[model samples]
Target: MIEDRPYTGLFVLDAGQGVAGPCCGMLLAATGAEVVKLEPPEGDWSRGLSVRKGPESVLHAAWNRGKQGLVLDLKDPAGRAAAQALAARADVLIESFRPGVAARLGLGPEDTGPDAICLSISGFGQTGPYAERPCTDAVAQAFGGLAALNQGADGIPHKTGPFVTDVMTGFAAFAAVQTALAARAQDRAAGRPPRRRVLDLSLLAGTAMLLASQIGEAALLGHSPGVPNVPAGCYQGSDGLWLMVTLVRDPDFVTLCRVLGLPPLAEDARFANFAARSTHAAELVPMVRDAFAGQPRDHWIAALQAARMMTTPVNSPVDWLADPHVVAVGAAPASVQGALGAVPFPAVPGQPQPRGAAPLLGEHTAEILSRLAPVPG
Candidate 1:
């Protein structure tokens, strides 16, 4: 219902593959930017990632909604020239090539107009010793300390199931591009000389940002610390359903124990406070698990809510879709129609839902290319 179209006349050229850069472009498009997604001849590699309905993958559909697609084989001279031209004319240009590839193709920030905002997303960074190193979401998670924090009960570090690092990097790039655009507009309004903005972002840096607090704690402690709150995790209920319970205040633990009818555990010296409970987590967690297992998930959830304790059923994706609150709030308000047929999507927070499906591979290529000036030899 929110008509948040602020970038009506802005032109965005998205020359990135995978999740991060496309996510940035998608967000820009949600704000009414005219985003042109430029891909290689085989198409954005994401199109073949998984669950492809012909040329459309779920990953591609999710991130690339509300954009026009243009396929160009940049290995060819004409393709490179066309991309450079698009980059030169764009208000914002996003690319995820290796450190120097964009520069070689003449699509770098230096090649663009002075007022352009160019965002370069990579595995490491644009100028580091690891600049050319290849990376993926899993790689970033492993290298950026998230895997360590995500260590399972079996003591094995695990990458998250979703593409978390790439998504976070996309959000970071989106914020950076918006900031640059705002700055450009302010300078223009003040009658100052226009300046080009080049943003260098990376999946590795984004993962670090995601684990900022954990990294800070590790630095301060000189060693890895245990989980801050003991027994504050998912527990299986009597009905064979799982629910997550978390405590922020020390008093909440006491309240939780009382709610679960384990007053003795609350009174135990070893579990007196958060620090004590964390120190004795090995002994305390199993008891808490046993207590939670004595009641159905709904019963515990109700009792905990009544006691002002933080808890909720660990809803699966289907459960989330059918949740009353999620439905009432219209969390996923848009249903995009495509080869997948009416796939529901959550609206971008504080922005309008995208008005179109992911553009087909080169859907508007001929129309868009016809409008461009002929490339000179």
Candidate 2:
């Protein structure tokens, strides 16, 4: 078993309620940080997301594990004071409000400890002209050119289902926080005062960076490869299930044809090279799809594996839960106890156990406030 390293008791002040900021806090907490999630008296907006038992919703539980919860009305003077007190002692502060909101609350980087690292995640950025505009993940993706790459053959753009911008921003914020922490540690070792830093992490910027390939194509070739590169999509298997294939090399294309029992495709001029394969993808994909459709998913999967061609069936939640490899790697556990009953939550990667369910709202409020109270003289 891999030994788990406990977080060295770094404090995190999570003032943001939604996916972006909370996800950052959650990652920190997973590494053993003491994350204090401050929500309004009514609770974080996500807490009321579903009719789950108590104040914990499915979304809230998934994003807020390993963190303590506190309720404070930021609009109230007392609430603001409590928040500032927490911020002063915190090592990291993550907020995802519109630009200027944290500053107005007096909880911005300048208002916190000099050593504190502040991560301000927003739709645009702090200094951008559109910083104050309210935006969602889809809007950010569109603004960042991700939606442009998602256009279909019809040339109409479509939104990706998941909130990619928010998720990517969360990951970026976590990285920035870790970098700040490392820098602060170095400063302390050198006997210099730890410098406070404010990271302006924009969802739009994060999404744009994630589209490096698309951006590079436009810059170098003067045109964007609108959809996924050819030979990198779902293909039909003989047994009616879909198998996704990604052939990055001409050799892999050869192996792909061999796996399908077609040797002539590799010799054909149109499908000979990667560039040619891409140009003739319309012709090649139908052939490959039709060949795959001739066999069952398992037979093709085995054949692809035998040829060392990258492949997998289109996996659903059910497929993942029942997969032998997933079970062997402990990706999905047997069951999880929730307020409703025992439900299955996927296992943690490289860990023996899945994380516990999120704590009840304000479950530790009394104990935490008591610890913070001044000692009697």
Candidate 3:
């Protein structure tokens, strides 16, 4: 077990139930914060959404590691009061309910103690025109223009395979909280009262900001370039193995050609420059594909790397688990017994692997409440 540090004793009030808010709380907890996951009496909606064996659902494990759990019926007056009381002493409050939900429940930032940082994560921002409406990760992705840029075959826009919006919003919320903490520390050092702040993080806004490069291209030019515009795409080798290549500059293009045993494509009149290569991508891509198809994936990967070209093998999860680099880096640690029996989990970066399991529902309710109650004089 790793020794705990002083002053990192942050309390996280996770009023949010889904991936976005819980993910933010999890990151804080992993880094040695005292995170208290506040769940409703009926538990989070995510707990029963899909394939769940028990409290050990994949989603739950992925989002609630290293955190304590507490269940309170926020709809009840006593429950709401208890949550508000906890928030009054917390360093950070993360809520992902629709706009105005926390305020209605009497848990808004204004009701919290001085110097508290409130992070509000939502589909839209707290003050947007559509803030009152409910939305999901897919909805936010579509609304954020990312769907348009992620179009698949037949020109039909598609949602990303994973919950991209939720994940991005979680990362944004964590960043906002850290910034607020830094500001508060500065204030304390200056002999001033700690400054309280509210972060209004929206899934749509976070995802849009992430697409800044694509958006900028579209704003300056008539359209964003297509995926196969340059020597950057997956190619099938002759052995039926696939290799991913990314050539960004003239040197990269030359290196790609050298690796493929072809004359420098960058020196050719028809494919000499970015513009020319883009125009001739249809011809160039197939040539590269056919050349790569003549060799095994490992051979081409080595050849390309030797030429200083960027390349990677497209691998599935099984391949990733057995990869040499993954083993060398010790990404996956040995199975450990928690509330749920022995389970394999990834190790924390720069930290020893946590041996504790996720908390059962309300596992720390009695202990936490005892600490929160005032002592009689």
Candidate 4:
């Protein structure tokens, strides 16, 4: 556990469902904020997503760790009143509703008082043609140009297997919240009243941020760069394990050729330099591929390292979990929740590992709501 708990006294109202907003709230919880996850009567939709055990599902565990739960049906007047009361006292409020849904429920930033920081996460953004349209990670990837840039060996653009865009949006939202918190703190120190801060983040915006360089290249260069490096891709060995190889300079290509026992190809005019190799890639790459096919991945890995070339085995999730370096660094730490058992999650690079399991539906409702009750005369 990290000893630095900066947000120890801060209260965060997390009225977000699914992944993006929950992820930011989870980070706040890890940093010692008192986060209350506001779910509907059926609980957060993520609780029913995949592999549910009791009140928690894999999605909930992955994104809602370390937060308390409050079940509130926004459509119900009483429930909406309870949420509004909580938001009024909150230091930060996070929601993932479509454009005007939060305002309709009276939980929008304008309703959360003047000093509260509000973060709204959505598919496109708050004011856009698609603001009201629903979207998911897959939709964001396809619509935000990520799929277009992630071309596969088969020449088909494929959305990543994981929910990368949603996670990216979460990270972006977290950063924005931190910035707002810092600014608010500065205002307090300077003896000035802080105004309300509203942050709008979207999956499409996050995807665009992730592909910033690619977007710049497309617009500035007016065409794709097409394969930045020749022969620097995945190659399958005889053992059927794929290894990724990369060459940064002309000498690295020489080293790769030497490692593959194709020293003559390094001197051959047709494949001598980066330009030549790129031009003749259709011919030269096959020769390198055939050479890699002659040996197991382990053999090529050894030879490539011995020659001081950049290379690594293409790792699956299982392989990553068992990787020696990952183990040494404690990259993925397991959090044990009763009944749910131990769940391994990647540790945030500079942040503390989350301390608790996701809360059960409305787990802290009674205790939390009682605090919001009016004082007796």
Best by lDDT: 1
User: What TM-score does candidate 1 reach?
Assistant: 0.97
- Decide which is better by lDDT, 1 or 3: 1
Kindly report which residue stretches of model 4 are placed more than 4 angstroms away from their true locations once superposed.
Answer: 268-276
Q: Please, what are the lDDT tens digits per residue for candidate 1 over residues 1-377?
A: 65878999999999989999999999999899999999887888898887777668888999999999898888899998888888888999999999999999878888799999999999999997898899989999999988988989899999999899999999999999999999999999999998999899999999999888888888999987778988799999899999999999998988988898888998899998989999999999998899889989999999999988888999887789889999999887656658877876776887777779999999999978986967779
RMSD of each: 1.9, 2.8, 2.8, 1.7
- State how far residue 161 of model 3 sits from its true place (Å): 2.2
The global C-alpha lDDT for each of the candidates, from Candidate 1 onward, is: 0.90, 0.77, 0.78, 0.89
In order of appearance, the predictions have TM-scores of 0.97, 0.89, 0.89, 0.95
Using lDDT, rank the candidates from best to worst: 1, 4, 3, 2
The RMSD (Cα, Å) of candidate 1 is 1.9
- Model 4, position 369, has a per-residue lDDT of 92
True lDDT of residue 95, candidate 2: 84
Model 2 lDDT, residue 142, Cα? 89
Best candidate (score: TM-score): 1
- TM value for model 2: 0.89
Candidate 1: stretches off by over 4 Å: 374-377
Assess candidate 4 and give its lDDT. Answer: 0.89
21-124, model 3: which lDDT tens digit per residue?
98788777766678888887777777666445656565666667777889888889988888889989889998888888898786799868788999898887
lDDT tens readout by residue for model 2, 260-362: 8888998999977877777888898778777878888889888888888888989987888888998787665544335735555654444333245555667
Model 4 agreement with the true structure over 138-256: per-residue lDDT tens digits:
99999988887788879899999988998999988989999999999898899897699999999989899988888887898797545667889999999999999998898888888
What is the C-alpha RMSD, rounded to one decimal, of candidate 3? 2.8
